[model samples]
Target: MGESSETSSAPETETFLHENQRSFDVSNDAVTHDNKKSGKPAGDSDDDLTPDDILLQLGGCGLFQILLALIIQSMKTVICWGIGGNSFFAYVPKWRCTDVDDVMNISSTVSPLTTMAINVTDTTNTTAYWNQQCQLPNGTHCSNFEFESSMHTLVSEFDLVCSQSWVTATITSVQMVGMMVGSFVVGHLADMFGRKKPFVLSMAIICLSTIICYFSVHWIMFATARFFFGIGASFFMSIYCILQGEHMLSKWRSTTISFPSWALELNLFSLVVFLLHDWEHVTLIMAFLAAIYLLTWFFIPESFRWLVARNKIKEARLVVNQMAKWNKRPVVNFERMVRSVEKSLSGDEDAKYSVIVLFRKRPLLRLTVPLMLSWLTLGVIGYGVGFGVKEFSGNFYLNLFLFALASIPFKLISIYLQVRIGRKFTSIIAYIVCLVGGLVVTLVQYIDTPYRGGLTTGFALMATAGVGAAWGPMQTMTVELYPTVARNTAFGFLSVLARLGAVIGPQFVYLEVLVPGLLYIMIALLSFISIMCIISLPETNHRMLVDRLVDDLDRERKQEKDHMDSH
Candidate 1:
């Protein structure tokens, strides 16, 4: 049956079901109820409702959903503190070689100097000197250095400058690798066990790892702590979106999924870092804030869709009843209603679905490949522009602030565009915007002007905004494309690719060292490829999510039939 079904369906096209099993079952169950009321032959059972049917009864967008949104939003924002802290904590303040005597006696107090002020012939004279050496080959040099900023950073504390400048960037790449591993592990755990346990455990990991970051006395120790922190943050972020999408109604999905919280965190975190320049203080503060989220253990609940998919009907019913109570709705024949959902879901109990299922079918593989490419572009451009924020011309704080600020409008515009145009077109347009932004930045690198710094920052801000714009639409597309059984795993697969992009992203700065303008040019190329990939995908504007993989293929067949009928 599966082989014949696959051969008949269009390999190039895939679709989400316009109506879900729960909604269809609700209508049939209503007919059964009416037949019973009229003293007619009532066929089958009147209690044939799914979990989503219970959700619809309790009001899809209600107090419970809103509460969960707030919880996810707040926690999502908090995790950014750990993910983004590297920018500030590893910030290399302006420094210069200190004075030394003829007998190798160092001065009690070092001179207040910038890289340009040092008149050393052998040392690199550039203001941004990653390759500058404190000691020349002649040995007539000072190894110790002094920084302009009073606050202690990784650079100042560990003297991670000159020969060690590359270490900071390496740590970020390592963290991205950790995030890749964490997403795969935590996503599988969420699918296998339940969303709540993994979600809460991830939060705890964030809190503890951040504290470890604070107490580290060496750079390697700090990097290790940061790696675990990255895992925790990625775990939390992946599950947060899944939980939000799984709970909210279909209509609100596009608008609800956005980057406002992420943008807001960057904006606020910049101010916090500026106020508290000390890295230790920043790490401690972030750890404390993350710990506060642990208190939300009682408030947050397991995903209803996850529970229903795993066949934990009793637990699903308890959540349903709580949701009903919070939304001020009364349930009738509650046990029967839940039992009907269980029976309907029982057919899939013997079947095991994982990320591998997405590749087992041609239609799903086609859809999955494009989404993976889109996310890879997102990670490359998003973190690529972000990690290089300090390299842009202008004050680091101002650049970070504006870069984050630019994201807010683009994200909002993406939501509006997805609603108006459709997911595929919106994504294509956003990628083109990113491509334009990248080209502008690349152009600035070759131009010579007094306002070059300002120009680079201005155009780079546009690139950041473009990446932000693509996020919301891409998330909506991912959620609407796959079935519940393999949804998080598919997302995890994409996340691993995205993190691979991120691992490559931090190296863009290093690439720039080898060839000027190489960073933005590469970003532009990826953005173009992403645009092409998006063009091949079908629009998923107002489709409902399917619970099983077979249902996804069935929807594709139905769509093909409808297209033929219309012709």
Candidate 2:
């Protein structure tokens, strides 16, 4: 009986091994099948992504899409009304026949008010001139009258009532001021709280304020609504940039960050054309788009990387596991992954000083000064050129479209060049190009006659290329230059200074036509200064982010010693 039992157990063991081998073969085949299905060449399977793998990637793409949608909608609304355009027709009162008759009779009976009333009517009307008697003066009659042909012409041509340029400028300026203040305030709030909460809350405010602005009849109400709108916009911009940067893989971060600005430029071009007819319609469209954020509550996930950094390890593990599952990959060993992450963190700490501690220490002032000056310069020149060009040029919508298109190739080319040629060389070249372009534009403007298309297009291409080359690397450099803890604060402070430039840039454009080129020249000089500041800074091309304060200090000291020894 014992011998029979042993033989039976041996057969069972053989059956178990056969089953295990089949399962292993199936898994291997599935992996190979996925690789084949991905359409990558045979040997490239390891490098190629499967459908499941691409699905896992959609998390960042989804976030970017929502953010881009919000920016595009805001750009449409802001550019439409903020830039000079025809006054909205909704503001025009329906001219009742009774009201018109009463006003005409009164003005005709009384002489002085006749001139005033006619003058107040639509200025486009050639027949709107104040006559001795306002009652259908000779050729001109009320629309109801049989002999009222001139009345139609008058209605079509007249600008009955209009806001002055100063009023428009003041309103726009107030909105920008609100944006400048709100950026700092919102950025701090985002750091203290979390990314998603601030984004949703600000979006709510944006929807509400936009609705209010749509209904507003008076300039004060409009301006006040715009202030709150700017506040909302400020919050969204800061949070979105930070969130996008964190969500992306290191290789993709800069491109994703730059993409939002590109979306904004594209929206500006489209909005300009759309708003030429009706602004209220545009506002309504924006409000509808803003409402899409409600759906994001279901789809958008919090940044997993941020969770890990904040010590929410369990949540981070769950998120990573979910990603693996979604990609149809084997479950990652949670404890092992956590250990690896911790080890990486420790290594980062060894490489750099604590960013938080750096802020408190006085000795780090040397590093802080250069960073601040470079950031401020970038803000002035970068945003200045961005916002100021619209004011200086005619047919700004067309120019903006061309400008955005020109930047696309530049962006592609620059990304390739930066990866190959190194950041410092690319950045310095960008600054020089911008400087030369600005000077060329200035010279063109001063010439006997302006070649409207050629000069504008040429300058635009040059400037766009310069910005495309420098902007991405500049953002990357700023993040790398500061330690992790101070990164947010440093960027926030830099953004504030940049906004200062944004505020001044518009004013500079509005001040005088001749001053734009001069302003661009000054901005070019500032860009040069920014480039100079970077030369003394350490190169951080392939380095991982530094986490600890003391380590950063030691590294810097050692670097300084090395430099001294070399000299």
Best by lDDT: 1
All candidates: TM-score: 0.85, 0.65
153 Cα displacement, candidate 2 (Å)? 22
User: Per-residue lDDT tens digits of candidate 2, residues 120-190?
Assistant: 56532444332213234344534432112222211222322222234544555666677677777765565
Worst 10 residues of 1 by lDDT: 21-30
Q: How does candidate 2 score on lDDT?
A: 0.51
Give the best candidate by TM-score. Answer: 1
User: Which residue runs does candidate 1 get wrong by more than 4 Å?
Assistant: 1-47, 99-133, 137-142, 332-343, 350-352, 551-554, 557-567
**Taking the tens digit of each residue's C-alpha lDDT, what string does model 1 give over 193-262?**
7678878887788889888877888889988987998788778867777888888656566767874888
Estimate candidate 2's RMSD in Å: 15.0
Cα lDDT listed for each candidate: 0.73, 0.51
